[model samples]
Target: MQANYVFRVTVQLDPPTAHLDPDRFETVCRLPAATPGTDGWLFFQYNLWRGDIADADHMQSLLMEKLGVEVIEASFSELETDSAYRAALESEIETDLSRFNADSVDAVVHQHLGSSIHVRDAEAIPDA
Candidate 1:
């Protein structure tokens, strides 16, 4: 049995950035629980991305240091299966067309750092 966990995080960027290089814009970080000898608590994940690499790094560091997000990780694979990732990308196009001209900052954040964890065989249980 396998379980998939997808985390959606919202971040606000000071200077708006374009999504030209979506691959370079996104990253993911994982923070394990702090309880002693605890098998399961919770894994906190964050996605950070923008137009510039420097901005992405700054956000990553902030989340790790100030936001109490530890065990930081970075990767592009997270977006492959994330539903929010797809939605966010689509939202960008919608925003671009809408008259309100609303900026999709939330989608931008997820586009950069969103992640998904698949727990292998974690859902299997023996019959009692």
Candidate 2:
């Protein structure tokens, strides 16, 4: 089964050195509209699949590093999907697995499910 996951991340600029003018700042950032009620603040919002959540952190880090801004707030706006909302997630998975010629969803899931590795520390990840 597949579900929709929406993420809304807001960031603020610390400009590194001199303060940035919104117009000039837009050159580096694609969505250049200034966040309401504040200058040098911006937002990035999107909807992705639940399985892609881990990749989202990598995306956030990349954006923060690329734009030289810090993420002030990050949130998941919507996380549930119903029968009324139909998507092509299965086909997408098929396309992704085409290189391996995975014949079906079960095949793909079985092939990759346990491949991801996890590490443990004192806090978030408990020792096995």
Candidate 3:
């Protein structure tokens, strides 16, 4: 039997700068997990920035509350069905990294399934 889950993560940038610094922004760390009676698992993607100056915890809390998403600390197992989804996520990370310059800025990518996942995090799929 397969299981599926969705991850909702909130990223907080430091200094609230005007431009994003790609070098300072490290790779996104994710904790994948599965839901009951599903075929795939959800993951958390986190981007770490240099120079601590913002409250990531506070920002995460606000985002989860505002978006009415369940936020928890857990691990997710990879699923074969998520191959395409992972590819799209990697592509977006590449794009964001490419756009990074020597500027202090912040951005967020909310990931989920279907409309729940932001386009920035998920790829565009046609109606099934």
C-alpha local distance difference test of each model: 0.34, 0.39, 0.33
Model 3 / residue 115 / CA error / Å: 26
Better of 1 and 2 by TM-score: 2
State which candidate has the highest lDDT.
Answer: 2
lDDT by residue for model 1 over 4-115, one digit each (tens)?
2222333333334754332223334333322311243112223323322234454456555744434233322332223342343345445453332335644433444333
TM-score of each: 0.25, 0.29, 0.25
- lDDT for each residue of candidate 2 in 23-102, tens digit (9 for 90 to 100): 22222222222222234211211212322333556656765775566754444343233322112333445555665466
Quote the lDDT for 58 in model 1.
Answer: 49
How do all the candidates rank in terms of lDDT, highest first? 2, 1, 3
**Where is the poorest 10-residue window by lDDT in model 3?**
44-53
Give, for candidate 1, the lowest lDDT window spanning 10 residues. 36-45
Q: Which pairs, if any, clash in model 2?
A: none
Q: Could you tell me the lDDT of residue 110 within candidate 1?
A: 40
After superposing candidate 3, which stretches have Cα over 4 Å from the reference? 1-56, 63-81, 100-128
What RMSD does each model have against the real structure?
15.7, 14.5, 16.9
lDDT of 3 at 75: 21
> Which residue window of length 10 is worst by lDDT in model 2?
41-50
Q: How many clashing pairs in candidate 2?
A: 0
